[model samples]
Target: MLDDFDRVLAQARRGSPEAFQSLHGDLVRPVAAYLRNKGVTEIEDVTSDVFLAVFTGLGGFTGGQAAFRSWVFTIAHHRIADHWRREARAPALVELTLDDDGGTTPAAEHHALDALGTARVHELLDTLTPDQREVLLLRIVADLTLEQTAEVLGKPAGAVKSLQHRGLAALRKIVEPEGVSP
Candidate 1:
């Protein structure tokens, strides 16, 4: 993916739709998944906004894949914050309930999510404290560095490190059986 990105990112920056599509294929799921974990209900809408920002600002950006990744995620993180702010300002709209024949059923969603292994991941992640989950998601899922995750969470690098270490230990204990050894 990194190797393909050199030429692809260059082409995307130049307004090549194919190149941008390729880049989107690589990034969209992770970005959307991260947003979903952060409780963004309209994941696709926010993901689209993030990509629009990325493409619009792509020409001015100069970086390798890691930098591009961080940049993209930075945009996504800000979008989540914006979503939160909007929600805080908005009044209650409607309540949604799941139905078997409805657009999105719990069983259907669960089955679909299971195919992506997201349900299991969610199950494991649900056991974590919010701070531990955030650190793990930013570092492991988003592929952010300790410094990057720290910046995102407004914590010191040492704090991020400790969170990560403790998060992993908790996950290990939860996932592993009593007879299993590390």
Candidate 2:
């Protein structure tokens, strides 16, 4: 899959519509999932924006598949931050309440989230700083090597490694409260 991604990115760089489509198809779900985890309820709209940013910025790209994915995610991070800022400045909306008739409400979203590990894992991920979260996601979820993650983030490999270490340590604290074995 990684090799295919490299080929698709190379072809897409040369302006192959089919290759770009293939790449988009491959990436949309994961990217959307990442955004959704970031608290963006409008996943479809944000996903569209992310892809549009990717397409527009593709010409300036100078790395391989890993780099490309990182770059796309970088754009997404910025977009999420922008959305946060906008929301912060906006006036608060009135809260609406609905009466509950003692019927069992649906199971918590956390219940179904174990497919990605425990809901606790996702909660721990949210505890990481943005830089740490980005490096961890790109490395673990996207399966990019440290060097590749660095390339995508436009950072040195050492920095990516440091971030990954810190992020993993944080996750370990949550996952293994007894403490990590040496």
**Which lDDT tens digits does candidate 2 get at residues 43-120?**
788888888888877778877666677677778767777777878898878778669767776667655765556455
Local error of candidate 1 at residue 153 (angstroms): 4.4
Pairs with steric clashes in candidate 1: none
For candidate 1, what is the lDDT?
A: 0.85
Please give each candidate's TM-score.
0.74, 0.67
Worst 10 contiguous positions by lDDT, candidate 2: 113-122
Q: Please count the clashing residue pairs in each candidate, in the order shown.
A: 0, 0
> Which residue pairs in candidate 2 have backbone atoms (N, alpha carbon, C) closer than 3 angstroms, thus clashing?
none
Candidate 1: where is the Cα deviation over 4 Å?
Answer: 95-129, 145-158, 174-182
State residue 79's C-alpha deviation in candidate 1, in Å.
Answer: 0.9
Highest lDDT among the candidates is held by which one? 1
| lDDT digits (tens) for residues 3-104 of candidate 1 | 788999988877899999998888888888899888788899999999999999998888788878878888998999899999899998897855655564
The CA root-mean-square deviation of candidate 2, after full C-alpha superposition on the true structure, stands at: 4.7
Alpha carbon RMSD to native, model 1: 4.3
